[model samples]
Each structure stands twice: as structure tokens, then as C-alpha cells.
Target: MSHPVDIHVGRKLKQARTLRRMSQTDVARHLKLSFQQIQKYEIGSNRIAASRLYDLSRILDVPTAYFFEGLGDAPEVGARDHGLDIVSAVASIKDEQVKSRIVTFIEDVSGRTVAKSA
Candidate 1:
């Protein structure tokens, strides 16, 4: 059986990759591994070593801590929240206007104001 921690990490990995708009092949190429290996890692079928995780962090342009976010929470609960991934992806947008527009669109659709940071 796959460990809960491992499954959590895999989901985070996949989430980061998706937020970055990267294919499994793209991430695999950066790590010099096959796409199947990337799939395995994302499915929790294979455990990722520390070095590999570091590499993934760099490739995904996220801090190492990103993978561990919400780890203390129940996996099902954490998995249901895509807010972090959306926020991260939006924050990565270099164009301020585009980011602002996206935030506005989200607020319009959700009918809730997102507090802006100073």
C-alpha cells in the first residue's frame, strides 16, 4: 500500500507540474528520466529521493516547502483545495496586468473579494 505521505507528495508534485503547464515529458526530460518514471513518481508508485525532489523543486520553480504544504491535514481535504495551485500559478505570471485581470475574473465568478497583499 502506498504511504499517505508519499501519496500526498505525489499529488503535490503533479499539482505543481500542472500549474506550471508542463507535461510529464517536459519534467522527465529535465531530470533525464523517462515519462513513465515521472508518472510513477506522480502516482506514488515510486518514492522520490531527496536529490530528485530538489531537482523537481528547481524545475517547477517552487520552494522545496511547497511539496509539504498541508501535509498535516487530511489528504482528502487537502486534495480538494486547488486554491494553492491557482494562487501559485497566478503569482508566477510576470505581467501585472494579466495577473490582475485573472484575479478580477475569479472574484467576479466567485462573488468574493480576494484580499490583496501590500
Candidate 2:
């Protein structure tokens, strides 16, 4: 029935993956699943088990709690919001530092930094 928490987590997963500039195939390879499964997970069509989610957190270099942040007041999340491919936008950068700086610049420009939320 697509629980809201599951949807939120999936959206967060997609965001984190994009921030890391990973493809669905990349994450799927780590999780030992098909890329289609990654797509399902990202869209909340399937729930990620705790252990698998933990493994994904490790692979994605994010804390386990990260996927749960900003949940209570979060807006509706899914691929339907303009179907934007955020990963491709960041994937062109080969330099990690450059990518990090770009992400920071985006956060600053969007005024959605952690301090603003706080």
C-alpha cells in the first residue's frame, strides 16, 4: 500500500545516490540486485529491508539516520515531480571536490541549507 515512510526513505535514497553521483546500476550492483529493483526501491514500489538499507547507507556514504531526516513535515515525494534526473546533472563532474562545492552552491542558492531549516 506504499507507506509514507517508505516513500520518504526511497526519495531520500534517490537524493543521496544523486549527491554521490551513482547510477541505479551502480547501487544495484552493490546490493546484488537488478537495476529494476533499484528503480522500485527509489520509487517506493518495494520496501528496503533494514539490513539492505544499512548496506545501502554504507555504500552511499551516508549515516543510517539520514534517510529519515525531515520526514515529519516533508512534502509529497516521488519521480513524478518533473521527472528530473538529478544524478545526470551531477554525474558529469569527475572531481569529488568540485562536486561537493557544486552541491554546496546549490544548497546556498536554493536557501535550503540546514541552518535555514533549523
Candidate 3:
């Protein structure tokens, strides 16, 4: 049976992959696994082993803890997809300056203005 944490982590993996604009086949080729395995992992139909998760973190350029970031809330699927969309938008930024501006804008929109670092 699939546990809640597994489902959540799977969603995180999918989100990271999507933001990277990576296909399941690409990830599978990198990890030497079948594309079906990656699909199963994304859907939580198959649990990811710790070693594989570590590999994924490196390949996806996220910390291992990223997969558990919002575990407490157990975000709904729609919320997860929306989060992915936002992450994808941010990841598409090619310039650090532009990305920082977007971050600052988002902070302002959220009513919390954080000072920019020098």
C-alpha cells in the first residue's frame, strides 16, 4: 500500500522533474531504470529507494529534504500542481537578477517585504 508520505514525495519528485523540463525517459536513462519505473515512482505506485532518492536529488538539483518540505500540510493534488506551475515559472528564469526581482515582487504581493541582500 502507498503511504501518504510516499505520495507526497512522489509529487515532489514530479514537480522537480517538471520544473527541470525533464521527461520521464530522460530520468530513467540517467538512473538506468525503465521509464515505467519512473512513472510508478511519480504516482507512488512504487516506492523509491533511499539511494535512488539521493540520486534524484542530485539530478534534480534539490536537497533531499525538499521532498518533505510540505509534508505536514499534505497538500492536495491540485495545490501540488499549482505549486509545480509556480516553480516551473521561476525555474525558467535565465538571469539571477531577474529571478531576484521576481522573488521580491512575490514577497511584496504577499505583504511581506524582505530586504534584498547586497
Write down the RMSD of all candidates, one decimal each: 7.3, 6.6, 6.7
Off by more than 4 A, model 3: 74-81, 85-118
How far residue 8's Cα lies from its native spot in candidate 1, in Å, is 0.5
- Residue-level error in angstroms, candidate 1, position 94: 23
CA lDDT, candidate 3, residue 108: 83
Whole-model lDDT per candidate: 0.81, 0.78, 0.81
User: How do the residues 11-66 of candidate 2 rate in per-residue lDDT, one tens digit apiece?
Assistant: 88888777666788988988889999999888898999999999998988789998
Score every model by TM-score.
Answer: 0.67, 0.67, 0.67
Q: What is the C-alpha lDDT profile of model 1 across 1-118, one tens digit per residue?
A: 8887787788888877865557789899999999999998988888889999999999888789888898887656445566756766786788979988987898899997654422
* Number of the top TM-score candidate: 2
Worst 10 residues of 1 by lDDT: 75-84
Residue 41 shift from truth in candidate 2, angstroms: 0.5
Which model is ahead, 2 or 3, in terms of lDDT? 3
Note the clash tally of each candidate.
Answer: 0, 0, 0
Query: Sorted on TM-score, highest at the top, how do the candidates line up?
Result: 2, 1, 3
lDDT string for model 3 (48-108, tens) is 9999999999888889999989789754676545666786687578897897778678778
Error of 3 at 118 (Å): 30
Q: Point out where model 1 deviates above 4 Å.
A: 75-79, 82-118
